[model samples]
Target: MTLQQRQLAADTPTRFARALAVTISLGCAALASMLLAEAAARDGFSGWDGIRAVLVFVTTAWLAWGASLALIGLFGGRTTALRPDLHAPQPRTVIAVPICNEDPLTTFARIAAIDRSVARADVTADFVVLSDTRDDGLAGKEQFAFARLLRETDGAGRIFYRRRRDNSGRKAGNIEEFIRTSGGAYELAVILDADSLMEGDTVRAMIARMQSDPQLGLLQTLPKIIGARSFFGRALQFASWFHGPIFTRGLARMQGPTGPFWGHNAIIRVQAFAESCALPELSGPPPLGGHILSHDYVEAALLARAGWKVEVDETLGGSFEEGPENVLSFARRERRWCQGNLQHSRLIFAPGLAGWSRFVFLQNVTAYVVSLLWAAFLVTSAISTLYAPPPEYFPGPYQLFPVFPDTSTREITLLALGVLGLLVVPKMLILLHAILLDRARDFGRSLRMALSVLTEIILTTLLAPLMLLYHSRAVVQVLSGQDGGWPANQRNEGQLSLCDGWAAGYWIVLVGAAIIAAVQWLAPDLTIWLLPVAVPMLFAPFLIAWTSLPLNRVLFAVPEDAAPLDVVTEYDSICDVWRLTWNDEHLMPKATSPDLTHATA
Candidate 1:
């Protein structure tokens, strides 16, 4: 029942709506660029002014685009629901959990929970643990964990484990290997990462949707963050729970059939994926050349190219994931993604790609490229200021008076407000939307939700400079041909100490101090303007460590915190009981690492 291309037209927005969104974004960008150019040209137009104008145009467009999406979600409302055939006999399905150097205990527990969850929903599905773990010691522990998991779930035959000798292709390659060998056994595969967990009913619901829509090749669920204990982590959870859906709803609306694939927490038609997504290695060396690091987005584009509907349903709930506990972990994850995205520059012109696919790649690249432009703008400004000509009093014929240049202070203020508005107005509007619709109840009622939003806004504002520095560095590293090898994610990277934060962030501190000193000495007028960004960097280690420290968990509370989902509660209980079992049997001693199940649980 492959859906025809014409059938998708009914679901897409009118050309007018899409056109209007682009119009709004570009218009905002244009005006902001104009304001910047005027301010820069007050003394005299220079190359630095031109560069600054272009940078502002690109970055403001992105910011405005983001604000536009939120507005679209707020106004356009939720997507029209596609009815599913829910009570029908479930299809042959396999929940594939991918792991690489992840904790065997916590990782396996998530699988066991998912296995038991599906069973409880009266849905029959096999669970597979695809391990690309490289450490021999970790591999030995994984086998023990698998045995324990099988025993606990009584999934001796239902659950399976396979470790690859050489994980050459990374995650995409790992999955490709699985499909190459065992994909034909199942019609649908629920792909999951080591940190991913979903409610039984959510999984069942997705399958139903796939069953109902023969044209649908993949369905992505909005996975919420859970199990956060640190301040930074909880803020991420709250924002995802609150702001993420509205933005995602807008994304889904705009995407129609050409949606996104975030690699995991998605269900795909195995046959469609196999036939369409045989990714080719680009013509080059490492970084830009080797196997594609970010394969999910490409897979979605491929599926769309093959006439399959790729969609994201933001309304569907119960999908879950974890976030980095601190800035360091986040930076590490972001660096790899940076490389993955910049690699897309090569594929932007690849043959047979859809127009939207190319645009999406452009957006991805622009997101990081904007950071470089910004850094360049600042450098150019510094250089220009250092060698600026002194104010001159010119006589038309023989006048003895010096004329001072207008600072265009008002223009500068207006431009700052416009840029600030793009960032703040969306969050404020979303807050108002929450109040109007009484959606705050979902985030622990109005007062706490409002407080959470306030804290998140402030915290994120403080972290902006840090992120800017990291993004710029990552882009530079990729350009320099540095390879950020495939490193396994440390899902439980716990509290970072001051020393640890300092170790990772000292360079930033130095940079910050240097910027402030140079600005104060060379450009006294700009010293006040740079304080907000410089202050945070000067205290980067403190900010990072403090955010990572264990918090009360009462303020930045999400829906999951207030009322744990059935699957989450069950997962915790199972882990507790299993840890006790391991301790009693002395399988993993308590004297080992702090994160070892036997020691912590």
Candidate 2:
């Protein structure tokens, strides 16, 4: 055999072995946990309460999550297969792109591209550039530039720009202003973030769904990450593109009419949103205070409460958005999301919400809490090793009390295996589905890509604990009244510095290093167990930044053949026509209609 072919053949078994090892480990851990629980029950150890609680929580959560997915699959299967016939009529729709202190040139270029693309598809979509910048100095220039650019380019009559004199509730406030002023004229509104892009078909599909089901208030599409120039950005894009669909599909199926609203790249029935979805001020501190940071979840809940459906159509393709390419930028984005999700805790138990709405709210809450719990589990496991005796059970005799015998090392090893399996096996299931179901082709060559999948999974497993640590700390800080102010994202692509990494992950590094050093000094034999935790902790920052780099992008490439372009085309054409019409009417007065001659002169 050729050397390259031999190498490829050799690597296959190694990858399979690694995957098997993870599966075996997780199975052992689960068995150990079960045995430990039974032993604790027989021995009457009071400390088992916490262990029992954890087991119950994990088991129940898994079942509930599974049931939700099954329900969604049943319902989703009933809907007619999505096709061109599903496209909604060309309604007068307002496309609102909200911006705040973003690069004007980039924003304008994207809007112009979208305008051109939508126009080509013959879509009648209006453009609204809603600015929420409070910096008075920059606002005037932005407004003037926006107006002139629209006139000079293809944005004249069809595209409009508005600046909130007082940026009150931020993004939510910006949208409210538009609805109050001119929302009545449009049947539907498509909200897009500055970095968001969609194909013409996706938008049309969304409109079609809304038209078909008047009860549907919002239709959110799964957005694929794109335009990632940096290494970090590319890695994030790859992971997001590769893993997002299954999870989204699972989530949507589970959520039904109570799915999440991610703020952008979704269509909303204007009347439903206007009548039921209003952002309310939280009468408290920084994270949960005056302005709502994360309005998407709350809006979705409100829509559900008001008897309107909020659905996430994973089957609807062609939506895309850019992710933060730098560590600092990624953190900044996370901070805002953390605060928003945290704030939802206040409304979760509010009396008026529907059961489905409550379920959705609880799901958002769980997303954050699960991170903190995983971090706690790691820390507590280490501490338990130091303070507690190994597990033991004893039978009663003619004595006052009986002590349990210590658990075998075999049992401990099995328990560890089970825990690892829980972490990695589900992903393998997803990969298997992709390969067998023909979905793997989107990633790359089915055979070669299988290896990439294994590699990505290993890297991700090593990195998961570190992310849990970062997000857990963020959640704690926000809950404790820490103010993570609105920080601008680092849009530039550059090499990450040691200081930048440290700044982002100092807590993780310090804790991990200290634990490793202590274990090495006091109990060198335990290094094997500590390696799993210590390695990830010590290199938390670098690992995070590296994984997000462009090198990882290749693994995430959605075989160019499967790329979603219908939505992209629609978005582009809509923006294009708006710009063209605006430019012709406002800039080139010599080509104006005869009726407008007096006004032009």
Instruction: Output the number of the TM-score-best candidate.
Output: 1
lDDT of each: 0.82, 0.65
Candidate 1 lDDT by residue in tens digits, 130-165: 888776777778888999888878988889999999
Residue-wise C-alpha lDDT for candidate 2, range 1-601, written one tens digit per residue: 3332232221333234324433543444455556545533442444533554365345334433443343333223223444444444566787899887664444665676666656655677888998876666556555655765686556778899988888787788889888989999999999998777766656667777777777778989888777666655655666666666666765664455566788898999999899988787889767767677778888887877677778887777667887776666666667777877787787889766756567566666666776776555445544434544444444445555667554445544665565565556556666776787787767776765676667766776676667666678789988889977555564443456666677777788997898788777754545677788788888887875665544643554554324546545444555465446544332322222221110000
Off by over 4 Å in 2: 1-80, 83-89, 144-149, 383-408, 517-527, 552-554, 560-601
Count of clashing pairs, candidate 2: 54
Candidate 1 residue spans exceeding 4 A from truth: 1-17, 386-389, 393-403, 583-601
